[model samples]
Target: MQEETIKKFMYMNRKAPYGTIYALEALEVVLIGAAFDQDVSLAFLDDGVFQLVEGQDTDGIGVKNFSPAFRALGDYDVTKLFVEKESLEERGLSPDDLMELVWEDEDDDWAEKPSIRIVTRDELKSILGDQDVILSF
Candidate 1:
């Protein structure tokens, strides 16, 4: 990545950590982007919402829980976090079910918060269309 280049990184995490590598790998990449000072955003849909829920008990699988790591994202300046509203509703979750990890003040009108920006499925698709770089894990 060059300072003169404008690059945007987007991640679509669609699987659960216990069942696949998506969530874990995404987390690692997000951290790496922060280290490199790149612009990055993430969307959680489908089973990916499981990644944000609190009290993730991965003890049985010997993998450390990752939800808490998200709390540290602000320090890295990777602040764009969107969760599809329909995805939460489909999974029987409201924004309240999640921990604060988004642009809360400006996005407060939305039910999803801390800093959540709610989007319909179509909007989600449209945003993905603009991703200069897209990663699906």
Candidate 2:
């Protein structure tokens, strides 16, 4: 059997969820990349933190809300979600303002656990340094 080379891919989301399509487009790429069985991780920074914010209502607009897609990432085996603490603070938001996202850990007896990790800006820098490839939006 041929061994598959698993490269570390980090998707850097730095835009707001609505108004522009960058956030949604980045999400589509992440979902596609997950299928290849590569080591995937998503970093939510700047206005990107708004993407995971709870209680999103797109009713005023004619667009369908796609925020729920973040909740399904676990099913695709894409569980590493990193949110920048500094970014949230700058935007006057906290962890409580975000949705509680969980994923099933098959190795841990199929246990459900939170998938989002709130990290400092310095920590995020370290994470970026460790990634083999980074797709920034």
Candidate 3:
């Protein structure tokens, strides 16, 4: 019997949810990576933060709102969503403007805990440096 090696995979999203396919494609890749049981993390910087914004209405854009798919990440054990603080501030947005995403901790009696982590640019850089593999979108 051999122990499986889990590599740290980080998906970096730097685009808005709509107006392009980058965001959506990155999301699907994240879910696929999670399915493989690899250690996964998501980093949202620049316009990527917009992907997590709450109350997104795309009727006028004729694009199907995919914000809800973010909430389902926890079900795939894909937590550790990192948002750059400077990016949010630069866009005049705050954590409150984003959707509240959480994951259940089975060890803690299934208690829900936040999955989104707000980090400064320096902090995010350090976190990114620690990843075994990083896929940018």
Write down the lDDT of every candidate, Cα atoms only: 0.78, 0.93, 0.92
TM-score of 2: 0.96
Best by lDDT: 2
What would the TM-scores of all predictions be? 0.83, 0.96, 0.95
lDDT of 2 at 23: 95
RMSD of each: 4.2, 1.6, 1.6
As for candidate 2, its clashing pairs are: none
- Assess candidate 2 and give its lDDT: 0.93
lDDT of 1: 0.78
lDDT, candidate 1, 1-137, per-residue tens: 46777678888877866677778878988888787666787888899887787667888889777777888776676778878988989999887778777433334563423545678899999888888998886
* Per-residue lDDT of candidate 3, residues 1-137 (tens digit): 24498889999999998889889888888877787888899999999999999999989999888889999999899879999999999999999999999999999999999999999999999999999999987
- Pairs with backbone N, CA or C atoms under 3 Å apart (clashes), candidate 1: 102-115, 103-115, 104-114, 104-115
Off by over 4 Å in 1: 102-113
